[model samples]
Target: MSKKLRNHDEVVFEQLLNPEMAKAYLDVALEEYEQDGDLGFFLEALRNVVEARSGMTSLAEKTGLNRQNLYRVLSPEGNPELRTISLILHHLGYRLSVQPIQS
Candidate 1:
């Protein structure tokens, strides 16, 4: 029997398939954002988690956004509105939360 090798990205995507793993991945991104003050990390994490779940097309449908626009808004170069981001997170079985930073 022969074993096939999966790409790095493929493995990461698989990790996101598990809810706990996906949340952990996003938590790391959130921590990075807190330290770096970069919203792009959060956006990218959301995009990856969404893709791992139902994909952009289904997410677009749930969010009432155009498929192409969803892709654009989720891209690293794209900036999405808070409402849009909240909606995506809600649909993906997650929600935005506020926390105090540790000193």
Candidate 2:
């Protein structure tokens, strides 16, 4: 079922309903990609894990991220740009990487 649009703002409709632009409004997720690898590689790895557990089609539907784009960003060999990485991480409940501190 389509979700309700309570606000009268036209942009809200576009952001929530438009396939072409909805992916741009996503926020960052939790900071888990810094554990032990290159930032992009770690993100792609986690994206795969989440996608497998949740199913990519369902995840894409809920996240407003096109499956094709998600694939490109999360593929093992893919080098996702910052915005794309941010979007995927946000949708997957993950966040950006920060280097661990030395004791």
Candidate 3:
């Protein structure tokens, strides 16, 4: 019998299909981004969630964004605008909220 190994990305995407898991993943990613200022890291995490939810085409249709634009914006080098991020999160069944920083 041969055993097949699942790709790491595939495993991640499968796990992220759950809303709660995706939310927690994004939260951790956001915290890491804040700590390291690595925009790419955060963007990649968001992209993973997007892929898990469906794909660029479906998200583009939901948010009325161009599919190509979404690919570009979610790329490692992509710098997305605030409105775009908000729209993406909204469509992903999440929202951004401000909380007081604890000292």
RMSD of each: 1.3, 12.0, 1.2
TM-score for each predicted model, relative to the true structure: 0.90, 0.47, 0.92
Worst 10 residues of 1 by lDDT: 94-103
How do the residues 51-81 of candidate 3 rate in per-residue lDDT, one tens digit apiece? 9988999999989999999999998899999
Model 3 poorest ten-residue lDDT run: 36-45
* TM-score for candidate 3: 0.92
For model 2, the stretches where C-alpha displacement exceeds 4 angstroms are: 1-44
lDDT of 2: 0.55
Any runs in candidate 3 off by more than 4 Å, and if so which?
none
Best by TM-score: 3
lDDT of each: 0.88, 0.55, 0.92
Q: For model 1, what is the alpha-carbon lDDT of residue 45?
A: 87
Q: Considering TM-score, where higher is better, how would the candidates rank from best to worst?
A: 3, 1, 2
State residue 2's C-alpha deviation in candidate 3, in Å.
4.6
**Order of models, best lDDT first:** 3, 1, 2
Per-model clash counts, in order, read 0, 4, 0
